[model samples]
Target chain A: MISTHLPALQIILPLLAAPLCVILRNGTLTYWFAVVVAWLAFAVSALLLQEVNAIGVIAYKLGGWAPPWGIEYRIDLLNAYVLLIVSAIGALTVSYAKPSVDQEIGGDRGYLFYTAFLLCLAGLLGVTITGDAFNIFVFLEISSLSSYALIAMGRDRRALIASYRYLVFGTIGATFFLIGVGLLYQMTGTLNIADLGERVAAVGPNRTITVAFGFMAVGLAVKAALFPVHAWLPNAYAYAPSVATIFLAATATKVSIYVLIRTYFTIFHHDFSFGVMALGDIFMVFAVLAMLAGSAIAIFQTDIKRMLAYSSVAQIGYMVLGVSMATVLGLTGGMLHLFNHALIKGALFMAMGCVFYRTGSVSIESMRGLAARMPWTMAAFVAGGMSLIGVPLTVGFVSKWYLLLAAMEQNLWWILVFLIIASLMAIIYVWRVVEAAYFMPSSAGAPTDIQEAPMAMLVPMWVMVLANFYFGIDTKLSVGVATRAAKFLLGDAS
Target chain B: MEWPGLYNYWIAIFLMVTGLYLVMAPQNLVKKIVGLNVFQASVFVLYITMGKVTGGTAPIIAEGIEVYSNPLPHVLILTAIVVGVATTAVGLALVVRINESFGTIEEDEIRELEEAQEDAS
Candidate 1:
């Protein structure tokens, strides 16, 4: 007799756990409690995903009211995948946070850090689980607020500025998103996304609807760090605490991409203003620019964290490429890439955290001969980098393969060329670290002796890297579900 | 367009664009955050106005209530408003931290200092 309210509890459990972290006020206790909550959330997400897979779709009306009247929570394959991503990242990072956070943040701020972490984890989970559009906004704010705080907690002074830039851009993004929602409500008089979809389909081709569509599209584009609007990302990731960087990098923009997919392909039918022409053409252009520009820029960065941060932009291009294709396989590639890139980047950033933990810096030049010093950490880095380069037997390769197939399906051979060129650029950037850390002599500040990161960090880091390999070969978890989910979304939108 | 039908939206757009410009173009972090607040407030107004039906009254649970504009948008905006406040509080907290560490809230000055530090390092 487990009810569908379990989805709400999955999110609320973490949200409620944050305050307890504050009251406890001990870093160790708070950290462990957060980890437990995250694990519990992961279990809940698994159960929800299972329930959805068994049933057609699980829709629960809040407060026992019917949809189109009251808020609801929908658990389908699409969001179930997202729920798994955010909650799994939450669980892993909190498990990995003990050593990385201890090294990066001060003791007095530790409890507060875990509190913000829980809120963020809850926000992301809530965003994935909610069926109501307004609920989406509420959860988005919860996540965004915690993200800003988490970024600002960096010991470096640059963290403040990075957080500020993120705040400005993130706020603008959220505002535009709200304006779009407002316009849709004005026209349709419903805040439920499922209801809005029905109403919008009933009354189409209006000026206000078109404008609202634009606003939400652009807002989500910015939030997803698409091309020109991604300026806030590198600095934010670079300056944030390592645990926060890994968590936010792996989940925040991915969830934003989820929102983008949901909006364009779910709430607004494909027949809207751009339909195929504008939506496909615009996203294709931006995805190409982001792919090349992000890789080119990443190649020049001296800082390891900054390089990975830029690489995230390039990876986002892969997801958007699938979106631009506007086919089921294309959307499948996009959604699966969203899940895959999170795995790769989470591992990469955690490796950086290991470096930060030991040497207290992530500058490439200073990382000379790291393979000799911290063999396990460098091995994790290499594995993650290979996945990023789209080597076979890795999640990254599977995603890019599908994306290439999608582009081929659309008969866009040039995008295939562009994607390969971008992967080459990724190689150059990734090679810089390999040469610096594995070949060159250690730099001036390099410790005479290098020590591996603690068990807490190393174990979680390897788990993600291994998951990348596991899912790459299996393909069932990442590919099968994404394909089905894409069909559902594309069919529903049409 | 009627006297106030579509034209009201025109005003909302103006205020929104102006607020967005302030948030994006300003060099001062505090001013930028203030601009963000303004921008979000404009959105709230847009949602409220959108909820207002021509002859409809406030949506209420009354005996034999006949017509109400729409309470859904109003409820949605309430959630958005709380989110807006939370964002403001986080922004102000960051500004306070920045002022403490760098002794300034000006974006350019902060960037220049960071550049210098990067160079020296």
Candidate 2:
């Protein structure tokens, strides 16, 4: 009986745990409680994915009310896949957070951090599961608002400014999304996503729908940190506490991209969106720019966190490039990257978190001779960096191979060239850190007594690193799920 | 163009643009929050306007009332308004912290100080 309600339970478990953490009030208690809740949420999502695979789409009505009147939680293969990624990352990050949080944020504020982390996790899950358009906005705010609190809790005063800027950008993006939903409501008279899918085609091409599409596209693009509107990301990632950086880097923008995919292929219908509207051309231009520019900027950043953050921007470009092709292979590539990049980035940031736990800084200068001191953490960083550069044995190479095939399938040879160039650029930035850590002498004023990050941090960091290799070799799970989900998204769009 | 018939939309557009300008143009943190509130209020107006029906009364069921405005959009906006208020509260709290740390809420001055701190480090 309870198994039937796993979808709702997936969100409720974390949502309830968030407030419970606050009421618990002790830092250590809240941390352990949060870890348990996160792991349970992860288990629930694993079961939810199993259920989705066993019996097609699962639509659980809120309060037993039918759709088009009450809200609904619809889980197709695509979101089920994304839910697994988000929840898995959330579990890993929550488990990894305690030591990093204690080091940077101290014990007094640890409960609040765990509370916000739980809220953010619940919100991301809610955004993914809900079939209602307005519910996405509400859950989006729930996540966004908590994340601002999380980002602001960093020890750096600049974290304050970063959080504030993100607030402004994030609110505008969400309001733009709200505007889009309002316009769609005005036209379709329904808030259900499946309901909108049917009604939107009948409404056909109109000014309101077009404007709504534009609003939603731009809004979600900002949230996704798509190149030009991505000014808030680097600083936000750079200044946030290491634990927060790892979690947000892994999941926040990926969820935004999931919504973007929903809007483009599902509601608007790929026929209207890609064929008539020619959105692919527009996205292509920006995606290429993001690839070239984000990577170029990363090469120059002294701060390793900011460098990886910019690399994230470039990586988002790769995902968008796959999306713009609008082929099944292309969408598969996009979806796979969405999963793979989360692993790649989650592992990379965890390694960085380990570094930050030991060294008080993540600047390149601070990293000189780091490899000699902290061999295990440095080894993890190098492995994750190789993945970022698309080394053949890593998950990044698998996604890139698919994207290259998709580009070839479309006869878009220039995209292949750009992809290669971006990978080469990844090599340069990753090399910079490797050289600093492995080859260069310790810099003046750099701490000489740095040690390996503790077992609490190392175990989770290595788990992520190993998953990168494990998924890379066994493409059966990631590739199979992505291709199935892609086919479903394209075929299932009404 | 329907002219006066779509006056509410015109008003929404105007407020939205003004609010957007306020957010982008101002440097003071407090002003930015105010701008954010205004921007959110514009969305609230947009949603509420979407719910209105011609010659419609309140959505409460009655013996003879047939033309009632849709209550769903109103409900959604109520939630949105609560989110907006929460955002404002958080924004204000950050501004307080920013003031305590940086000693100024002006964006330019803050940036300058941050740059100096970066240089010194």
Candidate 3:
């Protein structure tokens, strides 16, 4: 019975703790509360994953109300995998947020910071676990609102502007999504995702359905930071507090991608979405553009955080490219990249946070001779950077391999070429930082006496860095789960 | 084409396009927020329009109510309105902060200041 409630508890525990954090009013106490709640949520997610694996789909009706009438918390392999990724990143980032928060965001606002963080975490989990169409929009707003606050909490004055820009774009995205959902509800007269899927199939493709799909796809693309609509991401990530960057970079867009996958594969049949609509072809075009343009822009950014933010856009393209392929191997690659990129980017951003903790700057020029001073931090950065480059023996390599395999299976040689070229671009951008940190001599005014980041920060960073290699070499867990989830998504779609 | 039956949707579409245009075309941050509000309000109307039935009364228990309008979209809109209000509040708060720091709420002015700062540094 307790295991049955894991779906609800995963969200409730964090949601309740958010208000408690604000009530506590002490910075350190609130942080500890967040850490405990984050770890508890992670544990609950792990339990849910195990339960889903042991049995099958675990559906828990909210308030004991039956389906098509009340909201449901549905945990299939796909949901469980995403839940695991989100909470795992949440736990790791919260553990590392303490010193980083104190350094970057000093003041009595720390309690509020933790409160917003917990709310965002809860919202993300809610979005992942809920089986209702309307619930996704509600949770999406919850997370978006809290994240605006979190981004604004940064000490930089520009943070306010970045947060505002994100708010404007994010609101438009959510509104578009609502219109799509409203159209769907008008057609089907249901809000439950499973029931909607059945009804949508029965109704087939109509003008309303086509228009709804367009709105939802475009809306989710904005949230996921797809090419041409990703203007808000770099500034928001570059200027947000370090901890916020780490968490958002790791999980936010990944969850949006999950929403996209759920909408296309679960709610709309594959034939209607891909065959009739040709959305896969359109997605492929955008994915290619994103990979090239994002990397090209990143190569020009001087600030390390901004560079990583642009790289995130490129990395998202890789994942979307996999989904667009619409093959078993392709979906598997996308799913694996979803998990692997979280690890890769989470560790990379955490390393940047540690560097910022000691040096107070994240510009590439400021990191001259960082390898000599903050060896551990720079080392972790190197490891994470290698993973970003998709080097052999790293998780990134595994994802790209599957993606390449998928492309090859379709005999899409052009896509295969683009994947390789994008990886080279990743190497170039990541190498810029590597060269600055390792090879270049320290600037004349650079601090020679700077110390390595605190053990607390280094520990979590290394854990993720190590995971980049560990999961790379031992592909059993991530690859197996991803392949199974992909198969589940592709089932009955044709 | 039946003008009355399709007119509601046309109005919703017009409002949606106007709101979107304001959001895209405006340079003032506050004006953009207003645009966002109008955009969201259009969605509220759209949802409510879908919930309407010809000659239907309110979905309240009565002795002789044969056709009642669906209430779910109304409930969903209520939640959405709350989210919209919260977003507006947060957006305005951010604008206030931007004004305090940068001394102007104009997007062009702020961008100029940032570019100048970048050039100087």
The alpha-carbon RMSD values of the candidates against the true structure, listed in the order shown, are: 1.9, 1.3, 1.1
What tens-digit string does per-residue lDDT give for candidate 2 at A1-494?
Answer: 99988988999999999999989999999999999999999999999888888988999999999999989999998999999999999999999988999889889889999999999999999999999999999999999999999999988999999999999999999999999999999999999999999999999989999999999999999999999999999999999999999999999999999999998888999999999999999998999999999999999999999999999999999999889888899999999999999999998888888888888889888889999999999999999999989998899999999999999998999999999999999999999999999999888877778888899888988999999999999999899889988888788442
- Ordered from best to worst lDDT, the candidate numbers read 2, 3, 1
List TM-scores for all candidates, in order: 0.97, 0.99, 0.99
- What does candidate 1's lDDT look like per residue over B1-121, in tens digits? 5577677677777888888888878889889888888888888778877777777878877877677887766767787788888888888998999999999988889989999989977
lDDT of 3 at A379: 94
Candidate 2 displacement at residue A79 in angstroms: 0.2
Clashes of 3: 0
Give the whole-model CA lDDT for all candidates, comma-separated: 0.87, 0.93, 0.93
Where in model 2 is the C-alpha error above 4 Å? Answer: A492-494, B1-3
Model 3 agreement with the true structure over A176-214: per-residue lDDT tens digits? 888899999999999899898999999988999999999
Candidate 3: which stretches are off by over 4 Å?
A492-494
Clashes of each: 0, 0, 0
Docking class of 2: high
Off by over 4 Å in 1: A273-277, A492-494, B1-7, B60-67
Q: Scoring only the second chain, what is candidate 3's TM-score?
A: 0.95
Tell me model 3's lDDT, rounded to 2 decimals. Answer: 0.93
| Candidate 1, pairs of clashing residues | none
Candidate 3 residue pairs in clash (backbone atoms < 3 Å): none
